[model samples]
Target: MSAVTFVSNPIHEGWTLTHTGGDAPSVVERATVPAQVPGSVPLDLDRAGLLADGPREDGTAADWMAWCEWRYATEFAATPATPGERVDVVFDGLDTVAAVRLNDIEIARTKNMHRSYRFDVRELVQGGANTLTVDFVSALAYARGIDADARHGDVSRAYRGVRKMAWGFGPFGGPPAHTAGIWGGVRIERWRVARLDEVRPLVTLDGDSGRVQVHVRVERASGEPLTVYATVAGAEASAQIPPGEVTGVVTVEAPHVEAWWPHGHGPARLYDLVVDLHSTDERLDTHVRRIGFRSAVLTGAVNVADAGVESPETPQVSPRTEQVSVTVNGRPLDLRVERWMPLDTVLARIAAEDVRARVEEQRDAGVGVLHVDGVGVYESPAFYETCDELGMFVVQDPPFVGDGYRAGAPVQGEAIEETREHVARLAPHPSLLTYGTVEDRAYGSLVSGIIAVLDHDRLTT
Candidate 1:
């Protein structure tokens, strides 16, 4: 345990919804409501009987999809803290595009729904009340503009599904609509000196001894003395944490350790791993993770490119698909595959229980591997937690797939940034065994490349 204090407040209230009135609007009539994130305004209004069943026919919410914005405002009170402590406003998900301001000053701009965002707001935190507001824009507008003015032979499909409003979506599961809003809770966390930015633990066992490889990233006071410890099975390893940025691989050797196994293999035993960080003056941060010692090895491969340099009379054969499989603890799994569509078009409204129940439904069907499709935004936390607890393998396909890049297309700098955030956020999960991209060659390369650099433990497909 450590002394770091975090103050969290979910921004579930104090919000206003308005539409840029036009022909074919989802918010047919203007209305205001609390920011019941993870849900859309229409969904909330319908629940409250404020709006009639949304647009009974096609393209009814044209303006709604292409326009419409949600605004949230609240006054924040800074906590009693020491001089060196830092404060941050965190967002787990922002539907498509957002501009956030604190005390009337813009602080962050977010575009990817798959990424978690945070703004170091120490400079903006005031001794008195601080006003923070977030304005969300309809990305569909930008997408529509691009679609109309698209140059010939653009990369693959050029646009992504999540980028614009499409043919299928509404009360019924037709085409998909944007679930605009803060699709996740808005909260605040404050810390001092050192903060445990990230902790990724990989465990393996040999005979009765266990070997732990913990990747720890920390932010501490520059040039200050810091120490870190990894403890398990009554054994521990402590070392000096390098000043400024202390992020490195810390290996711990444990005796009489237990190994975790997947379903039907054996008991899925787990141990509580506690990594504590301390400065010269006081305890700074503690990160606790549920870890199991096991080996996940991906086997089999296929040739991605045809290197057949044949003469006029010669012929060649190319293997363009993957004949891949996985093994755990040296035991090959005859995997039962399970595929899920976008859990919800309105992602934030999805209840934790709902996601868990869905995963359980498949796990009960003996799903050894859950193919997290690369079609939509990343699945929710509940979805991943259930899979982790049940030992279900995740083939994480970052939310991207369409036509591949084309000849003379614009550089996909934004798409690359989105891929960066999605990969970094999902990298710590032990259940994520592979980084699988959709078949679009150009887009897939950009997406897979980020995963290649950021993740070494997981296999790339």
Candidate 2:
């Protein structure tokens, strides 16, 4: 595209955190200490020797921390934006409700910890060192403020209103530990021409041929002619985008494609799928991900199908019956399932090697499927990549458990966007067999509807 230029600077240092009594502005700082992005308030407190060693029987310290607001501040140097250029601060994840400010001016506000956010800062960023701050409100307080009718079978009222992990609120027999902070990486990106917003690759098989469709979306600076290119499994495809159009898809087909299989059944075959955005000869942005070719279906006791039974004396009647079985590549699979739990309550403390090791352990134990519970936060991308490599199937549940959450417009809207983002991230993995249905007292229908609309190819139970 029009002489594209893109540079990303990760802000990984010089972060300091402070706690305040509430969400309101506080001039008095309490216990300022060095902080880490992709970290949580509890983690920083422990590192600073401000928290107790182990879980307290009384939960006095934990309760106090959960009600206090925390703020993370940092400073970074950047050159001012030039003509036709854009600068934005991107957060991969933010724990719960928070407000982002640049140079003392509010730039953006975020509520969902599972969703990524980007705020254009070209106008606010300075040529020299500029202050960037994220102020997080008390997650427990915010959740408790939401007004919703509590129904029967509700697990935790504190977690029902907020889009957070339920396990931290003493659900699933876990200790109560309400976590908050920047739980993912933060970076400043400067670009011109256009940037890739999202890229999704979907694989399907037709007899001996495998088809891959890569859907791409871009944020453009102006109406310009662009092309989307995708290559996978030695096959390439390109699509010309109409001027001003922001979305396009490229399809590639490979004959006699090898299907990916679970461990002990067959070899797991994976291919690199690369998508590039181009304007004329220059490449604007590229997205790369590993994908495998395979089809998984859930049957028996889970998926109810209508069957017609004919009697000698009566006409045919349709009756729904449970078909409880799982199949890969049209063959029945004997599932050895294991529940995958988070290694730590502070998500950022879990490293990539830890995830790989845990999944490897499951694979060694002959676990074919990992039942990722819905009560916890979404695992990092490394978790799924490990499953894809080890040939382990994953049955992911939405972030809704046995709770009666408010189905207000705001709650429904957040849940919809969260499900969409998660499905897009997890759909390309051949190991992901099904997106489990949320069978809670509330939000079950909403979650199922979102999954059905976003990923109809995968089975839902």
Candidate 3:
């Protein structure tokens, strides 16, 4: 039997950008310039010598760019697909809002910059060259159209209605540049037989033993019986999944496992957990996750008066403050946290090495924890991976900041989904200790409920 095949083609070059001045999307015949994928409009415009040099005190350049619409176009040749093969256009991230088209046919519409998107383009892709266009609408215009009641009270109100980061919206930190573009990589994936949809590993330690429970989900073209194999720390486990079932679980236990520790305490030991999908003797897909065995808990004292549980008869009782503490591996850890903000105003300009360097600076300063502030965008995966290796703890806050804003159904739904994706992506990292949102009391119950349910292993404040 032949093994299933999977291939990825990255669309990185041959991109051209066009900028239009109006609020609506239209074609502009002037100043078309070469562009780069995984880049922003400001970066491209500056490269083409179209953008003004230096920051303006009046913020005219930033405001002008934020109000205009930008489009990026690229072309690539599609390869012929074999029988039972599936082709998809995968966007790792899109800044703010965008409409993606393949050969002039709209394939996907995205609004959130923090989430990834994928569109099935098997029918749209031809064997020859095809044109791909991503037309980005003005984020400022979109935010202005939202209802007044759905926004906060400050300048950040313009950014609250949309899922974009609030760092650039002034009054907050960073530049006043409201960025837009394909800030993440775009690629085409072709696969046969089956593909891994999600791979989540929950790591736990009991005394000297460590247990890893891997939950696997797959999408298959046929109703074939598949098996999932998980290997970690010299131990292996396999599960025979029945046909028509999309999910399976495998557990691997390691005896005499070393525990992972935070900085200043002990060595941060890490192990690779590899998972493979198999149909009989042939492998279909594989995934690898780096995990560490440790236990982190957040304990605190709650005040009855502050929690609104005080009665009139208890008027003599004073409102007590909550004293919070963190314990890791059955030892109390002193948290010396520093805010991890954006390294640059433009997201695409922040490289992996830059992230590593920033993290190293914090680690060298005797900082044990890096607090990912709520006002900033989600740090790239490289940030978490670096923290995991360097033995620094991370406490993350969701991107909501300032006075809590009321969100309509669409915005609220997207926020919930984005939270789910973020939790799933960051769960494997040992350095991730807890999640706390800014203005938690003002957010609606639905978002808080979703986070609590999805991240039951970690503390949510």
Candidate 4:
């Protein structure tokens, strides 16, 4: 793997944010930090003292949500494009939409904030000083042409899906919310041999032992020999890596392990697993994952027509159509809890301590389970970790709203991959009870199949 330069939080690099309202970026100014690459207009406006403090004269509060335009520009010293090495600019996340340019060349365009974007800047960037600019447009206007019907059954879901100003809403608006500007960070991933693309950790629990199936994916930048190394709970395993894109699995085991339990039952125990891409003895890239020893299942009965109950006059199977039960670690659990979601509109703004505080509050108040609408929404790693520590189970999913009403197979496929990613992120936590079913129960079976295809072990409702 090549050298990776993390330009996370561009604010620290003395970058300037210009509200480029016209055709080109006008010389503008704002504070920039290293971890602040995920800068947005609402956040910027609020910080700049431009956003309305309360309801406006027109009875609208968040006018800046659709009114502001942001141009984030930064200069960094970079190694010139090497003849053998490749340089790629990767933005882990952006807002609703953006146009990225390196030097003066247009390198990439962003549409959906949910997906990540990578642009090859091997030719555009040179050694020495470099100029990188991300022009973020108005998300409200850009979302106008968004095919809501093709994605979510309603445009509201599409609009609400994007990270905008939704939390702490009142009157016309309280805080301006728009999925604009760099929401994640701009990363310069430089590598010559290979780069670790993904690490999918599959963990399972048995009678007296806990196991982890580590699946590692690598992207071959050069046809150089490589091996993958994984270390979990002091146990280690290694495998040879092939060219192009390839996946390899390593098994790690711990005998006579104690199971994880929620709240009153017991403590949530977590183990760390570290994976590395290596060349002979040299470590290329490394990532650490957490795993837990516990399993959850949702078992119950579903009422069918019973062959004789189906008639033209009484077409419906009716209210007693299904009975769902919950169990944790093979033991039946009497579940009675209210679902929870943070009140904050801009979740990214919430600090880790704040998240932990909320989770603690919920657990202290006797919330047995946190029905996380979907794994995609309310996506805070701290949120999951806190639940794990507090022993509060989370019923997670892919996307919450407009589930069974999704438009096509592409959506379902996307959902499956996201579920895999989501499960992998939260796999180490013990507070997760079960993956929940889609809200739109009409095509519930199809959605369930999508989730099952990826997360095969966990129970789904």
Question: Which prediction has the highest lDDT against the true structure?
Answer: 2
lDDT of 1 at 32: 52
Model 3's alpha-carbon lDDT is 0.76
lDDT of each: 0.60, 0.77, 0.76, 0.60
Q: lDDT winner between 2 and 3, please give it.
A: 2
Tens-place lDDT digits, model 1, residues 171-212? 134544544666677777777776777676666667657787
**Candidate 2 residue runs with Cα over 4 Å from true position:** 1-4, 22-29, 52-61, 147-155, 301-324, 440-442
lDDT (Cα, tens digit) per residue for candidate 3, span 190-290: 98767888887878888779998887889887778999989999999999778888988899989999999987788999999998888866788888879
lDDT of 2 by residue, 1-461 (tens): 54346778999899998886653223223778899888887777767777745435422235566668889999999999999888999998898889999999999888888688889999998889999999999777777677343223333556777777777777656566667899899999998778888787788876558888887788998678888989888889999887889989899988888989889889899989888888766788888899999877665322223342212321111112122356778888666566677777667778899999989988898777787877777667999999899998887877777656777766778888887788888879988877766766567777777667667777453
3 or 4, greater by TM-score: 3
The worst-scoring run of ten residues by lDDT in candidate 1 lies at 310-319
TM-score, predicted candidate 2 vs. hidden true structure: 0.89
lDDT of 2 at 424: 80
TM-score: which is higher, 1 or 3? 3
> What is the C-alpha lDDT profile of model 4 across 340-425, one tens digit per residue?
55545444466789878878887787767666644236356777887777777776644445433334443444444445556656
Between 2 and 4, whose TM-score is larger? 2
Query: How well does candidate 4 score on lDDT at residue 405?
Result: 37
Task: TM-score each candidate.
Answer: 0.81, 0.89, 0.89, 0.78
